[model samples]
Target chain A: MSGYIEAGYISVFSVLTLYGGSLIIRVRKTEKKLPDLTEEKKD
Target chain B: MSEVNFAAIPQVFSKRAETATKIIGVLALLSLIATVWLGLFVTPPDQFMGNLVRLLYVHPPIAWVMFVAYGVAFLSTLLYLWPRTRDLRFDRLAGASSEVGVIFTGLTLLSGSIWGRPTWGTWWTWDPLLTTTALLFVMYLGYLALRRLPGDPETRAKRSAIGGLVAFIDVPIVYFSVLWWKSLHQAPTVLDPVTGKTYIHGSMAYTLLLGFVAFTLLYVYFVAKRYRLERLKYLYDRVLLDEAIQERKREAADFKAYGADKKSLVPTAFAENGPALGDARFFGTEEESVVGGGEAGR
Candidate 1:
């Protein structure tokens, strides 16, 4: 309810969400640059 | 020249592991949401700390994951160093885990500071636990930086494993700093170190437990994703290096066929409508051209 409590929760959640989003974006970008080796492995 | 054997590159994650990572990620997100709801709306404020105690649900869990991440990195480093078990995969895991650990460590410090501001009336302190934790953050950062230094893969892995080992020496110190020294930072709340008893009970305990599980799952998910990224980057660099090597070899062959006289030193590919001799573009870049020219001259 207090500003400190709100600040703590907001900061933690924001850092985590941002980091998670960045990781997904990076993985997608890197996957695009390389051939899908997972498909190659299947064949 | 031989073909680049794409099959030779190992898979970063198996199909089952990939599926498991996704499941873990979803579970982490759901549980994290639940933890926020329960900690904020459902749980009662502490008798003494009042509303400030809500920070407990998140701070300790983030700190716990920080420790676990570093612990995983330490073990991976050791595995990488062992002769029989030595593998670059362990090095990659160590690097990835340490990177994630650094993030969690940062969050731990940030949240801890926020709590401290209200409870202790100061945003920062010289307390042993806090100082050691800050030190742990810097040390792992140094470890990550060490990994990024230019070197052959084996050399870099070995150097980074040593750096990781050095950084991990502070982990236990950070853990016990509260007990080992007089400090403002509170001792472990979930499990009393002296009595081995849990202090909190009821919804508070359950919510805290959920926070732990949620963050732990998040750590796993993060490490999995980071490890895949490291592997992809490694493979991409290898592919580039292989291409560069193959190109150089072809140029060398052409030079040999034409006889490396002063006038005919240029490879046929370059001699015909390509970049001029000494042109950096012919060798991919200025730096590579200098090195390539040195090798070709020899």
Candidate 2:
């Protein structure tokens, strides 16, 4: 309700969302560079 | 002699595991949103702390996950150290958990500081609990840095495990700092240490319980994603190294064939640039040479 409460909630949500977004991006980028490991194993 | 078996390294999650991780991620997001809505609009303001007490739902749950993350890292470190169960998977898990722990620990400090600004009349303090927690954050950060240091896989894992063990010593101390010393920080709210009784009741209690579950699920989801990313990065590095080694071997074979046709005593490159190429160690079989080359490159 107050400024401090707003700050705390916003900070938690922003940090978490940013961190989660970065993880997804990094995983996608790395996956693109890599051949499918299961398919490679089959070969 | 302790060569990494890249073939043995898990490169991707099974389809079922991937699907399960996705489900957990979605559940984490949904529950977290619910916790936020309930904490902000639904729960009644505290009798003493007033509306400021809203911060409690997020702060304590984040702190709890910090402890859980570090505890997992410590357990994984111990498993990595045990000879009977030594595995790089445990090492990767430990790294992933510690990284996530660092993020949660950081949020705990930030949220606590925000609350303290109004409650304690200051943004920060040197109180025992606060100091020990800050120390815990820094130490795990050091452990993460140590993991990035260049070395062979086994050496890196062993040293990182040792670093993790050392960093984790601060976790218990951080938890008990409020109890161990006179401090501005309040005692545990959910579960009192002395009487072993919960302080909050009714919807407040349920909301807090939901906060914990939501954050815990989020922590699990983050760690799973991080572990998969770590595996992918390692596999990518190994693939590049294997390619480099294969190229080197091909060059060596071509040079040797050329030298044989010319009836030369030594290849000109080996003669001019020292015996780097001619050395038996350089031409050793892939298994023998990979570890040495990998360590050098790392």
TM-score of chain B of each: 0.84, 0.85
Tens-place lDDT per residue, model 1, B162-272, is 999999999999998989999998889999889899899999999999999999999999999999999988988887787888789999998787785755776665555
Worst 10 residues of 1 chain B by lDDT: B289-298
User: Which residue pairs in candidate 2 have backbone atoms (N, alpha carbon, C) closer than 3 angstroms, thus clashing?
Assistant: none
| TM-score of candidate 1 chain B vs. the reference | 0.84
TM-score of each: 0.86, 0.86
Q: What DockQ results do all the predictions give, each relative to the true complex?
A: 0.56, 0.53
Q: How accurate locally, in lDDT, is each candidate?
A: 0.89, 0.88
Residues A1-43, candidate 2: write the lDDT tens digits. Answer: 7899999999998999999999999999987887665533435
Q: Write the per-residue lDDT of candidate 2 for residues B141-209, one digit (tens) a residue.
A: 999999999998899999999999999889989988888899899999999988799899988899999
Listed per candidate, the RMSD to the true structure in angstroms reads 8.3, 10.2
